[model samples]
Target: MDLIEELMQEITLNNFDVGSSTWVDVTYINNPHSFYVRPTSYRSFLKSMQAHGQKLEQQDLQLSMNIVYYSKTLKNFCRGLIYHVDTAKKNCTCDIYAIDYGCVEKSVSLKNMYSPLLEQGLPPLATHCQLANCEPKNGLWKDKEIDAMKCYIGTEKAKLIVKGKTCLKLIVELFNSCPDDIATMLALTGYSTLGYNENVFSRIPNFKQEKHYYTYPKIEPGNVLHVRTQSGKDLDNFYVAKVDEYYDYINNVNNLLAYSKQAQSLRPEDMKENKAISVFVPQFLRYERGIIQKITVSEEKALVQLVD
Candidate 1:
């Protein structure tokens, strides 16, 4: 059978086509209205990727870039496309785009690449979908909206009611145990605004899509000064401790900066109860863990409690 036809047949069997209401795992949420889903029983599509994937060597990176390859990104092998190759060094790494999840991994090593099978023509396993007839109030997504969706959709399976489809993505409404369903719950709680007429996830603006690389401190000898050690063993392990401290300090500062930036951009209306956030405590003089307990937009005040 033709590949597309076979794929459609499987999608129908899984009840993932339009007018099908099935339980799906809400995997990744790009925004309040945009998310990715995997049917509880995705079936043969996953099995084919796992059973037919073939590993490749460093010399095979160029040829593998043009086709779908299995990338061992940690534990599970992901079907991805290598978009760029870093060939300046002897051992090259590539930037890979995981089609199913709609995410990217940079500087991936050659060992992760796996050549595609000759007959591997199926759509991405994770279906790109969006909440039907719903959008954010300000025409943008915030951390709160994303957080709300995560809370509503927890680890349990979500109901995907496929209303229709666009040229690329499915127009759907996701529902949990909430009385109003995901869309109505968001709207009632003010996390999202209603009146969206079509599938808008594709047209919605993504938040902070730019990527930046940082220069990390090397742990090799003579790379950094201040070599103090109590014994030979301590001396040998000095670089490791130093590097760990360097990363810890960098991470802490970055966290503080990110929190401050997000906080500044937020209005009183954006604050929601039980929303996870980082706050600068005057007594501690550093960013500390906190959860918003109460929001009073009229008073421009929120009661936040620090938590472990």
Candidate 2:
């Protein structure tokens, strides 16, 4: 017989307790409900050992077992079975309780038992929002638009923005100072770019400082003015109107629209292909109520606006 078979035979012959109450309890009661195995019967013991070996293999671990002996009746049954295992190169030990006053005990040996491999895995690192394919619907803010804008700024530009070095906040502050023409405001705000070719303001010309031949009235609350570009075909105009009741709603809707369009048009695909660039909308004014409305745009004339 093989060494394993010899060891099994010796354990079975020496520790077998066919008539003991503990053997009956382990075989009939505990084995049915728990992992307890009474190896007094050869067939049952071999089957249990086989199952245990399969379990260890599934977990990518190794283990080994042996029989112990002790005399009992007094001393609170000091004798118990020991199962030794290794995990991550560290020795781990488990003690099995002795249920009967027997001189011999039987146990199984297992090698390299890696239980973590058999357990459930960990959750993903990035959330659903972080995934490129995930779309979050109906939130206080559009996550996709925000994420796209972040991507456009690239990692470097984002650092500058975080440090408050970007011109977005300054532009918003200038637009909100008072009722003024776009060019005048830009000049007063020290942004020659508004009237110059390289200036960011050239994209939105509807609010130009140049006087119009058509008579225009002063902007006020309750006036729904459609600020359209010179060609009137492009909706790149600022509508100077008051929405006292639904001002918040209009602002949110407008900001979301602006960010959405910016994200879509200025997506990395468009930029890499020499298309339009995406602009970042200042977060401070994303929900602020104000007098003059401002729309910033990219060099390609794509509109970027403050909703309120």
Candidate maximizing lDDT: 1
Best by TM-score: 1
Q: Give stretches of model 2 more than 4 Å off.
A: 1-239, 244-265, 268-279, 283-308
- Cα lDDT, model 1, residue 31: 78
Model 1: lDDT of residue 179: 83
**What tens-digit string does per-residue lDDT give for candidate 2 at 30-65?**
110011122233333332232212223414322112
TM-score of 1: 0.53
C-alpha lDDT (0 to 100) for residue 200 of candidate 2 = 23
Model 2: lowest-lDDT 10 consecutive positions: 122-131
Can you write out model 1's per-residue Cα lDDT over 245-279, one digit (the tens) per residue? Answer: 43223223322432243344445655667766667
Q: Report the Cα lDDT for residue 67, model 1.
A: 42
What is the clash count for each candidate, in the order shown? 0, 17
Clashing pairs in 1: none
